[model samples]
Target: MTAPMISFEFFPPKTAEGLAKLRETRKQLALLNPKFFSVTFGAGGSTRDRTLETVLEIQSEGHEAAPHISGVSSSGEEIQGLLETYRNKGINRLVVLRGDLPSGEVSAGDFHYANELVSFIRQTTGDWFHIEVAAYPEFHPEARSPSADLMHFKNKIDAGANTAITQYFYNPDAYFRFMDQCQSAGINVPIVPGVMPIYNITQLARFSDVCGADIPRWLRLRLQDYGDDLASLRAFGLDVVTELCQKLLAGGAPGLHFYTLNQAGIISTIASHLNLQGD
Candidate 1:
């Protein structure tokens, strides 16, 4: 059997302690030999410097670092400058996004959606970078409709996105249906499923709400049965994610991208189930 291609997403750290934790997380996950790793950008490019530093560190440690960029946070020139900085630092991949609006605020300006960011990256970099765009199996909260959301996705691909990494979902059917729609809409690029093992039910629920990923009643009931048993909860979460990965692989997913949440144990457990191990 062919080995599955795996990648991880991490957020930039904000303090000395957080940076140490981030580095430790990187070190642990790096043992799995991921295809690449991504660092998320904060709202309005707030974590710009930290994101760059983390990417550079990952590259220094012999890993591909794909930095996230938000079109809404930057003008063309500013975006160009950021790309140039990454290029100089030997980074050649980006996760282009139309990031969430800041709290208690409205619009950010310049670019409103991901397609514009894709277009801008292609125009500015000329195919020197591998660009990844976000996809929604359950639909984005701001999207007009499922069809409209897919139309926007197709626009991003047409603009030069090489792949679409979907938001995490509990149901494999949702991903399968989304892929069918993507194919019908002429998106032939790889659409990797993003998997987030539910560590904390409440926190995951909040995030799912923001990303429009539905938590099935069955899953909620299962977690509720575990109550305050941390060890049992962790085991159950790993098993659930592992089962999800197996189903996706069986259904022909190209690869898996983990939202690691700056931790490695859960991802390691899932990878073990997938028959992938650190060398």
Candidate 2:
């Protein structure tokens, strides 16, 4: 069987100690031969410099890097400069998003939506970069309605996204249904499943609440039952997430993109469970 093309998402490290730890984590995960290592961009470009440095470092280490970009607060010139930098460094992929407005900030900047940024990238870069946009199988929290969310997703593809990576989901049916809706809407690009390993129950709960990713009552209760038993929590979480990955692949999902949270053990464990760590 052909090996699956896997990728990992990481945020820019803020300190030298954090960067060192990330490098160590990257070294371990590199064994899986990931397609690319994507670094997250912060809201309002807060981590712009750190993101650039991290991506450049990844490239220096002989791995493909996809830097996230947001046009929500950047001008044409600013985005163009980023394009040039990525091109110079031979970075060919980008995870594009209309990032959240920082707290207490109002202006949506020069661009309002991800589709506009997709259009701008197409116009400026002219196919030089492979753009990846975000998709929400469970619907975006800010979307007015389900159909509206799907329409906006299709709009991003219509503008110029090469493919999409969905928000991490545990319910395989949700992804399948989302894909069916996309197909009906005439979107033919790959919609890779985003996988987030359940590492910290509290952190996961907070994130899921904000992003609208349901944790199912049963799973929530299970985690809550674990209480302070982190070892048991992690093992159970791994099994659950691994089972989710298996179902996604078996059901014909294109690929898996792990939101690694800069940790190697959990992702590596999940990878081993899927038999993806084998040569």
Listed in order, each prediction's TM-score against the native is 0.96, 0.98
Query: Which segments of candidate 2 are over 4 A away from where they belong?
Result: 277-279
Q: Which window of ten consecutive residues has the lowest lDDT sum in model 1?
A: 270-279
lDDT of each: 0.88, 0.92
Give the C-alpha miss distance for residue 141 in model 2, angstroms: 0.3
In model 1, the runs with Cα more than 4 Å from the true position are: 277-279
Error of 1 at 41 (Å): 0.4
What are the per-model numbers of colliding residue pairs? 0, 0
lDDT of 1: 0.88
